[model samples]
Target: MTKTWLIYALGGGWGHITRALSLGRIAAKHSKVRILTNSPYAHYLNAEGCLVQWIPDSAGFSATCQQVRHIILNAECDRLIIDTFPRGLGGELADILPQLQHIPRILIHRDINPRYIAAKNLRSFVAENFDAVIVPGEGKDLPFCDLPNVHHTAPWLIRSDVDLPERTLTRSHILKVNETIKTILVCCAGQAEELPLFAEIALKLHQEFPKCAVRILAADCPPNCQDLWISHHPGIECLAVADVVVGGAGYNTVYECAALRVPLVAIALKRLYDRQDKRAQAYCYWVQDIQSAIDTVKMLVDRIEPQKKPLPSYINGAVQAVHHIMSYKF
Candidate 1:
C-alpha cells in the first residue's frame, strides 16, 4: 500500500510552511505528502503531489483544536512530520500522539528558547513520541536535552532550479540608487504590520549608504511604500541582485542567505516562542541592534569592493533531510 506522510506545520509566519514545503516537495516524490498549515501565506502555495490543508480562523481555541484533530483522524497518514513545535502550536497533537504510536513520528527541530523547554515539558513530550528529531543547519543554538534519537542535516532551503530567474534578466531588474552601484536588500514575509518596521530599516540604510540602492522585498506591499518597496518578486530572485540582505533572524532568511553566499545582517525580533538572537549568533552574525546592523552591512558592502570573506563549506541541508526521511524504515 502507498503510505501517506502528513506534515504538521502549524505556525503563524511564512517560515514554518516554507520549511515544511521544502521537505514535502521532496517527500511527495516518494510517497503521498500532506501539509497541515495555518499560515496565511499557504493560501495558494503549490507543491506537486502534496496536499496543503490551511486552517482558517475558527470560533476560539477549542474550535481550532477540534478542527486540527478532525483533519488528522481523517488523513489516515502513515507518518507524521512535525515542524518546530513538538506538540503542535497549542498542544493539539498531544491527544493524537498516543493513537498514532503504531507509525513513524519525526520532528524537524529548529532553534527555541530554553524557557520553552521547561514551560512546555518538551523534553519529556518529544522523548516519548518522536522517533527521530532532525535538526537542520543554523540549528546549533537549539537545546536538545541529550535526546538519543536526535539527528542533524544541512539547512532546509526553499529555492530550487525552477524558482530561479534567468541569469541574463537578473541584472536588468536592479535599479541603481546612486553611483556606488551596490544593492542592500531588506526582506520579510508578506505581513502587512511587519512592513513598516522593515520599511523604516530600509530608509535608515539609505541614509547611511547613499550609493547603495536600498530595496524592501515583501510579498504584499502597500501602494504608498514608494519605489523602494518591491512586491510580487520572489525573495530568492531579489537575493540574486543583493550585495547585502538585512532582515529579521528567521529560519528561511538566515540559511537561504548563507546558502546563496549573500551577506546577511540579521536583527533579532521578539518572537513568543523563537529566540532569534541565538539563531543569529550561531551563524556568527553580530548585529544585535539596528546600529550594529548598519555597521555590519556597511563593512560587508565595503569589503566586497576589495575582497569578499570566505564562507563556510556549503552543505545542502534540504537534500540531506530528504534522504533521511525517504530512507528511514521500520
Candidate 2:
C-alpha cells in the first residue's frame, strides 16, 4: 500500500501555509499527501488538491484532545510532518503523543533557537516523541542543548514560481519622491502593532531627507493610514520596485528578501508567543530597530544600492526534504 503523508501546520501565518503548499506540490506527485490547518488556509490548500483537514478551534486542552484523537484515529496516515508543535503555543498536543505512538513523525523548525526559553520548556517535555527534528540552516544561533536530535537540512521550500512582474517594469515607471531622498519599502503580516511608530519614523526620515519616499505595505492597515499602506498584491509588487525593504524578520519575508537580493531592516516586536530577534541577527546587516518608518527611510537613503552578495533560494529545498522523508524506513 502507498504511504500516506500528513502534515499538520499548527503555526498561524502565511509561512506555514506556504510550507504546506510547497510540500504538497512536491510530495503529491509520488504519494498521498494531506495538509491540515485552520480555515481559510484549509480552504486554500484544499483548492490546491491536497486532502485538507481543518483543526477546529478549541478553548482548552479537552477540546484539542478530542480533535487530535478524531483525526489521528480516522486518518490512515503512515507518516506525520508537524511544523513547530510545542512552539506554536499549542502545547496540549505534547501530552497526547503517547496515544499516537504508532506513527513515525518529523518536526520542521525554522527558528534560530529550537530551545528558545519560551518554547524550550514546552518542547523539552514533548520532543522525545518525535522521530526527527529538521533544521533548515547551519544551526548558528540555536541553543546547543538539542544538537543530537536536530538535522541540519536544506534551505526552506517555497513555491516553484511566484508570479513576479517583469523585472524591467520596475525600472521603467520608477517614482522618485525627491532628488535626494531615496525610496524604501516596508511590509509585514497583519498583526503589526508598531505601524504607528514606524509611520512616525518615516515622517522623521522624510523631514531629514527632503527627497525620500517611504512606501508602507501590509494586508490590513487602519483606514487612517491608507496614504502609505500598499495592500497585499500591490505591496508584493512593490518589492521589485524597492531599493531597500524593512519589516519583521518573518521566515517568508526574510527568504523573499534574500531571493530578491533586497537589503532588510528586520524589526524585533515582542508578542506573548513570538519574537524574531534571534532569526534577524543571524543574517548579516539585518538590524532590529531600523523598521521604524523614519529610521528605515533614512537607512534607505544612506544605502540605496543593493548589497554585494547574492540571495538564497529553496528551488531544490523541496526535493531535498522529500528525499530525506522518503529515505526514512518505518
Best by TM-score: 1
Write model 2 residue lDDT over 135-244, tens digit each, in one string.
65435455433746666654554443244554445434433233333566666542435557556544454456555466666555633555656554323345655667
Which ranges in model 2 have alpha carbons more than 4 Å from their true place?
1-3, 39-52, 55-65, 86-88, 112-127, 138-149, 160-165, 168-183, 190-214, 233-241, 272-274, 284-293, 305-316
* Overall local distance difference test of candidate 1: 0.75
Global lDDT of each candidate: 0.75, 0.58
In model 2, the Cα lDDT at residue 207 comes to: 54
In model 1, how large is the Cα lDDT of residue 192? 54
> What clash count goes with each model?
2, 6
Q: TM-score for every candidate vs. truth?
A: 0.87, 0.73
What lDDT is obtained when candidate 2 is compared to the true structure? 0.58
Question: What is candidate 2's CA lDDT for residue 166?
Answer: 49
lDDT of 1 by residue, 1-330 (tens): 887889988887788888888888777777888898877777646564578887874436787778888887677777888898888888888878777777788988888777887888888889888888899874455677368887798887765645566533554554334323678888876345777778777888878988777888776663445777775334665665577889888888877777777778887778988877777776636576778888888888877751133232455677788788777775
